[model samples]
Target: MEKTYTRFEHYSGDRTYQNEQLVEQALANSDFDQAATQGKGFCRLLDKAYIFQDEKLSEYSIVIYTLDEPGLLDSAAKREYVLSEHDEMIIHRMAVVRNGQYLDKADDVQIRILDHEEQGGRGFLTNRKKLSLIIKDLHLQDILIFENTLVSHAPQAGLKRDFKHVYQEFPDPFWFYDRYVLRTVNQTSQVMTYKSCFFRDAQHQVIDPIAIDLPIGESYVFEADNFTTDYDPKLEVRPFIDFATKASYSKVSDAAYQIYEKVISQNSTWLETSAPDLLVELAQHETLDEKIRFVIEFVQNSIYYVYDAEIMDGHEPQEPQITYESKQGDCKAKTVLLKSLLDYLDIASTCVLVNYEADYFIPFYCPSPSNFNHVILKIAYQGRHYFVDATSRNQFGFLQYRSVPEFMYYLPIEPQADLQFREPFWHQNYLVEETVTCMVTEGVGQIDHTLLLRRQNADAIRQMFKNESETYLFNCYTTSLYYNMCLTDNFSEKELSEYFTDSKIAIVSDNQDLNELQIQHDVTLLKPYTVRIGKKEYLNYWDRTYLDDKARDFNSRDLPFWLSHAREKLTFELRTDRKINDKEKVTLQECKIDSDFLCYQTTKAVDKHGARMTIDYSVKTNAAIKGEELANYLSSDKKIRDNNFGMTIDLFEQGFFDKLKKSFVKK
Candidate 1:
């Protein structure tokens, strides 16, 4: 829209964005019918551009929202954006368009900067901030413009010029149109090339960004005007485009390995200074597998996970000696330490890079360290390769049976390689088995819940046991049972504390080597049958939501539901110590629902005397669910939710209840 775009030339700080021409252009393109169709505040403009000037990549975005109704004024005061501590954000423009005149509010606006540590509890300590701007006195049909540019700084020391992997965000989830453009000027010695994935050309074929060769100072204006998005844009893997000088995936692998090799060589004391105390424990075990297990255990447990903005994280591991002395490192440092110990023990192992979120689409991404977000050690022993993540603390046992993230693709740090399809190596079992048993004695019911967890869930529970107090754990169990039994989301602290007065929890069994954990949660309720009378409903244990939310990610016609990520199954057993002689209520029927997303099968079994009722629900993970099959899948999901697993129990014999009170009183 402007010649030269000189404000973006040197990338300073806090420049007010002004482009009235571009704003008018985008507003003219905005459709009123689409805006009315959405029935919400319509977005007039969403112009995002990536201007790569050699080693630096600065993203300039200008989003303008038109408040169509007075109701949307509340949202106007809540305009805020997050900024990384290291990066610089430029508030280019802040203005409002009314009656074809711009009210310049940039100079007078008072924006509050807040400490936005939303996920600090999850152990991720990123120094990011949230800036909130207040727009006062907003009216109907007023177009508010917010323009800013974020100058992204490279993560760390080694890869300054290496433009490896970059994630591009998707269009805003509005019914309006947006623009995505990329402009660059290569002012370096390296040849500049770009690769993008997931975008389709006019022929409906997957567009390959590898073939795109941009000359010096070339401007790439990617047009996506008529595109419509129905699914959550956050979950969608938007066009993943990155610039890299490397020719192929093989070259990219070679470059990465060379960097690692050089770093290891520079810090060769890790190999020469003899094994540390943590690694020396491997000598106590005779077998190679035992020694490998010891090494893995030492790195996993000894070194706690600390997150840094490690891009494969910053693409370089800390010096092994530093990591060992500190006993804390990110995924890259931990894996490097584990690999070093394996080398000391004369074991053959290598570090692998993978992306848990992208799963299958990783193969389509350009070969760069940025495509991979996690690192794990892959041990080659006894004619097979077993992957183990150093960040995982609670996993135990031999290398083969040990659990790992189900990333569908992995790239090993070798001389040359491509993204290889990873097959299942870890043993698969029921991740969780929940047994809810209710027994009544003297008009009081004791509902005992035994949870048997394996693998990933086992690891999670072990963390809870280690970190949380017994009282906290007991309260958690009580809260869970209260929610499931009552089937309500509404919670009052006063009532919850008063309810479940005699709740107790105990760790029945915990075997770390086998990766199994079992806990019991029991609560005594007074006349629970009276409160939950006539066809008591129970949730299907794991799938408790009203509808399957994962099904919505594949809402688009092109993207498929990534099934490799959904590898765990839940087995729930519900029982009651009461007789159910009614043939209609206890017919012992087995129901099965097969859909493209998942297969759900449930069975009801009763004892010979009909004294106890046990209902079981089971589902096995399958392949990816394509979008075309989502309708049938959603129908099955709706069917399961609509019929909320009702179980009718005979609390009393016919006419026995009415005679009890009268007979006892008169005699």
Candidate 2:
């Protein structure tokens, strides 16, 4: 049985080639037919118009030459050729001619001629003419080694090959590039050879392979040079119509306008008198606070967030009528409804496409819709723009979580509206206040803490907590300890069942030595601060620093908000004030005993007494003393957020109660 060989030609320009006859003729050749029957000789055309070898071949050479017009190579017409090899070969401009036929098994013989961009002439090795193929051990190793050494030793070399690629911009858009190579190999051996071009451009762009068919033990080398280009800043921003906006509101395109016109045309007096403009009418409320509060309540109570299912159901962008039909949608739907309400009221609003996680307000030269996975609304009122995200709960007025920053928002004002993105704003501060009081009786302790927070900085803290909770469980340890170990609340009780429902249990203890302990803490943040659970035990563990991955690496200097001990302006106080009041005069001696910052320990007397129980207590929180000055005398390692000082009181009014709990019994 005879196999067949098929040859295809690739050419640049916008035209098609009918090569059926040429392919049929080529298939008739005995060698071509032999190769084809063996499932070896198959070829595909590329953009640059050249004959390439596609099938695997271990003991064969691939000869590809650019064709003339009409995609055909005429060797007799003008004797003009880009690259041609006939009785000899050239590697890096170094010609090598075999004196005799070089024949041997093709095992362990690998050759790779990578296609690259090299405009100027480049070469390293001179011609090594009349070479010999030293073959041995049923392997074509010597001849292949001789061939590779000549090219590897060369300094300046270039290859000849190019592949074609299709660049698509989605929904009826495509561009093309020519870049690829021809491969050859023997049928019995796994070794292979690649012939391609040499490119000088460092920014190497290549053709996409339809399917890779390389077998085991085959290798390829690609030589890509540095090609650089200056970016035209004008390409940074583009205008994409987000129809859900005040400007886009019209009877033709917007659903709200259509509904409004239809309702009014019916001559319904009730709708005319009761129906209010949804946009500017709301903004005209007597107070900004009222408008904000209304909007928050309307969105939070009215809409339910459904994520995965909504996106997966292939829901199209809802028209105003459709949104009103469901009375709820996802983020996009919520945004559109809000926009319509504001639009009816004549409020200026714009719907922005965003990748909530990516932070669109931050300058990203690579503008991509993929980066923006979510959407938000920006409303302008009283010469100020407010960012409204209805996806969250408990948000009011202009209050944003600490995780949001000035740069994470994109107003998406008209395309012509000069909006230059900037990096995250630094130097923002957060203030948090917490007050805790603990009362311990016998082995049981009861504590109460009140915390107040103020928004004073970029919302980094809120975002930090979100990030930690989602991935690393930053506050898990503190919450768990309180619910489990501290016995602040009983696990079997029904009153506080909701407190620890979200947390997973790690350990359970039923030790009878444990006393009933109650602890309550209230913490408030005026500004978003990364929520710290209890202390900075695992500072960097599980914290994914995207700033490092997206832009530059992180360093200490990059942490501009870092706190230092010397610069700390903080106060933390603990005190126990004891005073005994006497009612029956002289029956029992009246005394008032109080101590601040008390500590208990066993001590040895130096003079005569060997051992004694010692109690050391001191009072330092005078309310008048400067927090910074007081911190100097306390533990240097401990710190409190803001200048808030802590105070604790543990007084023993009667020794009998204490003695009852202890082993000592009065005789």
Candidate 3:
């Protein structure tokens, strides 16, 4: 079991390996320990890849050698391969080797094929098949080696499939001993581009591949040995790495637009048909915004989203009529339907592809149709461009939805249009205004709260109110009261609904120009404003700043933080029956912090009977706070925190015995 030599070797042509000498050579040149622990087992040796290219076919072969421990028997015993018909890729060979001997026994291996549809999940229809294998008699310290080959058929005319962009990492971080060799041959007339870089030290250093022109075709080779190390915390927030190779296209967007064109051309016939009666009726609204909203809502709510990856043919979208008839489709289908609806209304709209995740790496990689995962509709109306995601059921205000991140890149699929990355306009006019009125009577308190939300905030709140169930809404309010406000008493579902219904105010008003939604509600607490300590009663008002938690310890973070541009105002009015002394009044003060990135203000007023406090806060920037700006941002945050954005009052009630004692002491 103590065989010391391990090596891996791959040849360019149809040559076959004779023995284990290649594996020994690879192990001798590297500092990899074969017996080291790597998760379940050690991948002690890797003769990774042997690729052969021609004008019509591209073939790839990979061989992996594993040293299994007691717990890692299954790791070397089972394997799975994914093959797709759409890519015209197939597995040509698979086998297992043990020690220095090939496992030629048929009883030692089992193979099974499963269609992706039978796997049961929601995703793009890949039309892929899985080949699974299980090997028996796998034991500890066993060198289990397996080899497989894949051949990709040449793509048909007008369909660009020769675009090869291969990204492989050598000396994999998870493998105790790993090696890689990638060789690519371009048999076609198209020029091939290849690039490679070491992970840590190769910043801004470009390494060009050495290309050799053979009698039949050209070949490009790349080899690397990667070592892992601790990275700077600031590097965590850096943009994605631009490392990839592409052939047959100059720009990444060019390849992407070609795929988009194919998909759009195949589905454009659906737009020529007439609109459905329901859509026709909905489109008869007086304003363009109304018609747009009606169509968006219908598509978002009426159709179900089901992604059948088994039947999906590459990036092509299904016909709009098919989606409408089936009442189910993925993002592409929904976007196609939405675009068709816009076509019927004579509105200019296009399908735009976007990556919704905040930390997407597609921008740095070689551009291909696979980069985008989500599709949204972009419309030009009233001299403005608006982006709409019809796949989402909860989005409101069409273009003013706040859930969509600002400054994300998007690709619009349109003919004669520049295929470049673009960003949506950053909206900053959203407002959230809250007013609370409190009254105390006989140790109990009644609180009335009113909120006016405008623009993006209004849309979000409206969608929440519309979609959430009554029980869910009640739970949300009760949870907030209990955790944030320290209100322990709970209300039943019926009682909570009744309280909401009684205190709810209508949205009607004379100011028809206003685009804000007004919500008013009232709640009664058993002992809302005071906590008794012996004979004295202390006021229990809590600080109400929404951003207090975010401001706490923000300076300690190494990465820049993102602050969405928004304006918020909160007002509170307090009234109590207890006798109030002049000195007992809450202090009246105004605090303000103004910077290029943020603006904040807080004002307080006190009267003989009650007091009122108002706070105005706004973020002026929508970017990350880094370097010197981080200090300024933290300064503003500290000012807001120190001013007591949610400061509570420290008022106590004096008893008759305490007043008499004070009077006697004064005499």
Candidate 4:
């Protein structure tokens, strides 16, 4: 006699409706699966031992709506399912949304039972069947529906599927639908992708997949696979990819013409007086740095960054006025505003639309707006093109500072177009300085690290930090050996177990599993340096994950080499400090600890053995640092800020090698 609750309801024609109850008491009984199955069954439970055959319906109908693009709705079909009930009949319906279109056409709209059921008190119905469907033409606004079921005599025809089946039902919104435009340098090509997974029609299930070759100067490929009843299948195939309209590029469309006249081509009254006055005022700011800083700060902190390309409906290239008027724009709007501001200042700037999410160094070369998710301002300063995105606040420096390997940046060549493309190496010179220091106690440590980064692409830096904020929290370490140690306000043992790994013991909070922690890492060094040790084995594990694999790419064995060298020195430092037993004394120095950057100097000191060790590092990368160096530093820094896990960590030996071994030793 257990009570159960149903989140949703299904109904048939008669006054009968399907309900669910939790079998709390049934668990104590002999039959558990039977009770659970009765409450959560998908197929019908036929009484009197009757069997039914699957068959196709007489007719099929479908309706489609194109909400995003025109050719997005061409190839389309529909499907529906019907189920017979004792009192009345019920139809279970489902639809697939793909390529911004709906696949309504179904191939085999039939159902079969797998398990047999005995007519008893909520007897077991061991039958499992699947409904199959196929459709063509998919796009953004695409949605499929069981038209017949919705219009049926039953009260409910709305199709429903469980969370486990969500992927098959719809394409990942984050990975596909949620993505904005990502374009190249010339604005000639672009790429579209989403942030996460979503429900979409599986490829194998798609029947009669068709491609719409647009008059645009582009090619397309459409595909699908695995049509049978394999739920949650990893079946993947390309479907409905098209290039830009060459005809439209040669002769603008009515939409483009209307947009240009309505926004871009029109001369603004503000340009006559207010705009010129603002420009003059900006110039009078005393120095180029001041004016540039003002522009950078204005764009970064003020505008609320949001990608609205998908939501603009039929809107093509956005106008600067509209973006300025709206006070908000996606990547396009923000780019336009920055360009306009630069124009007002009489700065030589170009408006470029590129995919900032891919190929950070290379400019995207495409005419399609679909590939450009970000709009940037390109200014030629001293014979170099500097990329700047106004949608960021934490970003500091030129375009190279914000460039990611996968992001493609697009730039507008002419003064009239929204944005075009550019090259990746346009603005390649930049520098970053980081210093990390820590003081270690028996099982505790304190770290202080600072970043002094310099660059010309201010816009790029702003955006980098916006996404980097979350990543930054988890990128560093309280201790490299105890890299996973979490800092929280509470000391609950449950929270401690959830956040604390065996590598790091966090006692900053009181709720830790002190019993387990004390016992596991109880091995202590005699006195003065009487630090407890936790998992020394993890030191080898750390070296394996970082020093071995990661160092190979750089062709450098410095991490392991430094770790080994540092370990030897630590004994002397510990021994010397233990004998002296002085807490107030501090040591300092300037010396190179590695070969990567010779300018970097390491200053460190050990006081009272396990009580503390401090390090202050400084380095100046070569003036010509570009390409990988620029991209790596920017991306890594942004990643650090974006992760919110509460600690920063790096594989560099100098960054954490000493602290890691000590963390394990003191555990």
Tell me, by TM-score, which candidate is best.
3
Q: Write the per-residue lDDT of candidate 1 for residues 1-667, one digit (tens) a residue.
A: 5111112132243323446664564457544436645664355556666666545567777767677765666777566777665456666676778887777666656667676664442246555677667776667777787676776665444554465334564455455554333344444345556666656677655565554666655555555654454444554445556655445677767777877886554433554464455545655788876777777888888887777652334577776777778888888888988887777766788888888776666656556666777888888887887778898876776676566566678888888887677643323555667667666543455677788877667778878888899778867776665555553433454466565658777778987666788988778755344323454422223235324667744455556665433233333333343444446443344456765454555555555222333323333343455655656766776666654343434443426755686468667
C-alpha local distance difference test of each model: 0.61, 0.29, 0.55, 0.32
Candidate 1 vs candidate 4, TM-score winner: 1
Model 2 alpha-carbon miss at residue 297, Å: 3.7
Task: Put down candidate 3 lDDT per residue, 1-667, tens digits, no spaces.
Answer: 6211112224345545544543453334345553364352235344434243422444455554454555556665776667555332333333345455554423566766676554233333554677566777776655555544455443453223434444554443344445445565555555544433323435632233322232235565544443222233333322222222342223544544566565454543454464456755774777766777777877887877766553332445767778877888988788888887777667888887677663234444454444556678888887877777777764445443324434356666654444344432334554778887777766556778777877656666676777787567555654444333333333343444433333333343212123467776666655555444554443333444445455455543334565665578888776666654435433454588888677778777766555677878777544655667767877787776564464344454667986787679669
TM-score of each: 0.69, 0.34, 0.75, 0.39
Model 2 segments more than 4 A misplaced: 1-288, 304-317, 344-347, 360-371, 381-384, 393-411, 422-432, 439-444, 453-573, 576-667
What is the per-residue lDDT of model 2 for residues 1-667, given as tens digits with 9 covering 90 to 100?
Answer: 5211111122222223233322332223232223223433222211111111222111112221122122121221112111111112222111111222232223322232222222222111221122322222321111111111111111121111111111111111111111222222122122222222111124533222222233433432221111112222232212111100012112111332232233222322232344345334455767555665465446645666544322412223454445555656666667666666555445777766444443532222122222244556677777855567766553333323212323333425233332323332222232333333332223233333432333321122333444565324314433432432223323332323243333332212111111111223332211111123442110000111101121122122111111211101111121212222222221122122232221111121211101111112222211111133323323221221111111112122435655574645433
- The numbered model that scores best in lDDT is 1
Error of 2 at 554 (Å): 6.1
lDDT value for model 3 = 0.55
What is candidate 1's TM-score against the reference?
0.69
Regarding TM-score, does 2 or 4 come out ahead? 4
State each model's C-alpha RMSD to the native: 7.4, 23.2, 7.5, 19.9
